[model samples]
Each structure stands twice: as C-alpha cells, then as structure tokens.
Target: MFLTNTLIVLATVAGMEAFAWLAHKYVMHGWGWGWHASHHAPRSGWFEANDLYALVFAALAIVLIALGTSGRWPLQWIGAGMTLYGALYFVAHDGLVHQRWPWRWVPRSGYLKRLYQAHRLHHAVHGREGCVSFGFLWAPSPTRLRAQLQAAQAQRRAQPRQAPPQRPPQADTRGR
Candidate 1:
C-alpha cells in the first residue's frame, strides 16, 4: 500500500507539474494577462492578480482533500503530491529563482540554470506575448539561458521610450 501510494503520488505530482507549465505558458501569460501584468509592471503594488492563481490551486487542494477522505487512497495520494509540488514550487520559484528572501547560495546545476533562463524569458516582456518557460523547477542549460536573458534585456533596453501625454490649459481659480 505504501509503494502504491508513493507511485500514485509521484505520477500525480508529475502530471500537476506539467499542467502548471502549460497553464503558465497559456493561461497565465495569455488570457490571464490582466492579473499577471502586475508582475511585470515597473512599480510594485501591494496586491497582484497573479496571486489568485495560487489561491485557486489551494482551493482545488481543499476540494481534493474533502473528496479523498472517503476511502479514495489514490485521490488522497494525488492530493498529497499536489500539496508537495506547491510547496516545492514556492521554495524554488519564489525563494530560489526570484530571491524574494535572502538566501546566498545559487543553484549550481546546469539544468537549474536553464529553468532560470526560461523564467527570465517569461519576464523579458510586459505583455501577454513572449517566450514561454513556465516550469517551476528544472532548467537544462545555464549558459544558453544566460545568453537568452542577456539578449532579452538588450532588446528591452533598445526600445524607444514614449513621452507623456500633453495636457490642456486650465483657467486660473484666482485673479490678481
């Protein structure tokens, strides 16, 4: 039963990870641009719509747990796997990749670098369109990723800045 549970959890986690990648590429970066846009905006805000995706996933977990309690071992295992994956994603994406908190050691693996590069590509643009690198963990090559990141940064810098809109003259409230 333990082995079966382990296998089920592993498979479910893998599926969930893949689904996350696809959703990031399509939904989050595509149709869901309204929420995710805050992430790319120059100035930071107190709340971002991108967080709703996490909330939705958490709600899904709660539902899965409720359903799994009724003699559904497979479902329970899958739920466990998803919860684990979320935790891992938080640690990897928010913690390691983004450096939201202060941790000094950088990931040394080539694969991890690739994943970072992919994420960098995702952040390279402000709108819904760009190269998609949605996986929370796993990058295949660091050098290539670094190159891509540099290129994207250069491209962004090369774009011309727009001037502020002109305002119409207003009547004075007080006359001399």
Candidate 2:
C-alpha cells in the first residue's frame, strides 16, 4: 500500500508537468491572458494578478486532501504530489527564475542554467503570442528554445505590419 501510494504521488507529479505544459500554452497564453498578462508586465507590488492561478490550484489540492482523509482512496497522495509540485514551482519559477524573492543566487551551470535560460527565452517575446518554453519544471535546451524564438520572430516580421498592441511596462530584470 505504501509503495502504491508513492507511485501515485510520483506519477501525479510527472502528470502535472504535462498538464501544466498544456495549460500554460493554451489556457494561460490563450483566453486566460486577462489574468496571466500581469506576469509578463513589471510587477508593482509583492504580488501580481497571475498569482490567483496558484491559489486556485492550491484550493484544489486542499479539497483533494480533505476528500482523501474522509475515506476516498489515493486522493491524499495525489494532493501530496500537487503540493510538492507547487512548492517546487514556487522555488524554481518564482524564486530562481523570476527572482520574486530576496534570495539572489543565480545558477552558473547545469540544469539550473538551462531552466533559467529557457524561461528567459519564454519571456523574450513581448506579448502572449509567439512565446516558447511553457513548462516550469522541465525545459527544452536553450539552443532549441532560442531557435524557436528566432523562427517565431521571423514569422511575425514576415506578416503584414500592424500597430503593435499596448505593451506593459517591461521590467529591467529580464536579463538576470
């Protein structure tokens, strides 16, 4: 039973990454841009409107855990996995990549560098469209991401020119 629960937790974590990639690309970058747009803009306070998505996911995990404790099988483990993913996302995405916190250790090499560079490439685009590297925990190679970005930029340039959308105030911290 313990092994089964562990497997469930691990599988859920992996599944969440795939789910997150889909949701980040379609929902967040698509119709949910109303909330997610705040993430791209320079944050004025300690929080952005995008943080609400995390709250929603956290609420789901809480509900799953409550239901599992009430005798529903496996949900507790699933919730545990979700909670773990959320914590990792907070640390890697919010803390390390975006530098939303005061801890300022930049990764000079290895997977950390790839993760950082991939995310930064994601933000290289000005608006919602043409962004790359939607996943948080798992990222593609930085070289591949840059090539994709370049292709996207070239495609956009090839299209008929229109007045650009009203862009938000870009933060100066993108290079870091």
What TM-score, computed on C-alpha atoms, does each candidate reach?
A: 0.73, 0.90
Write one digit per residue (lDDT tens) for candidate 2, span 31-56.
99999999999999899999999999
Q: lDDT for model 2, please.
A: 0.94
Q: Which pairs clash inside model 1?
A: 111-139, 115-139
Once model 1 is optimally superposed onto the true structure by TM-score, how far is the C-alpha of residue 24 displaced, in angstroms? 0.7
lDDT by residue for model 1 (1-176), tens: 88998898888788988998888878878888788776666535545677788889878886787788887656777888888888888887777667666565466656665666667666765677645466777543545655766777688789998889989898897985
What TM-score would candidate 1 get against the native? 0.73
Instruction: Output the worst ten-in-a-row residue range by lDDT, candidate 1.
Output: 137-146
* Best candidate (score: lDDT): 2
Total colliding residue pairs, candidate 2: 0
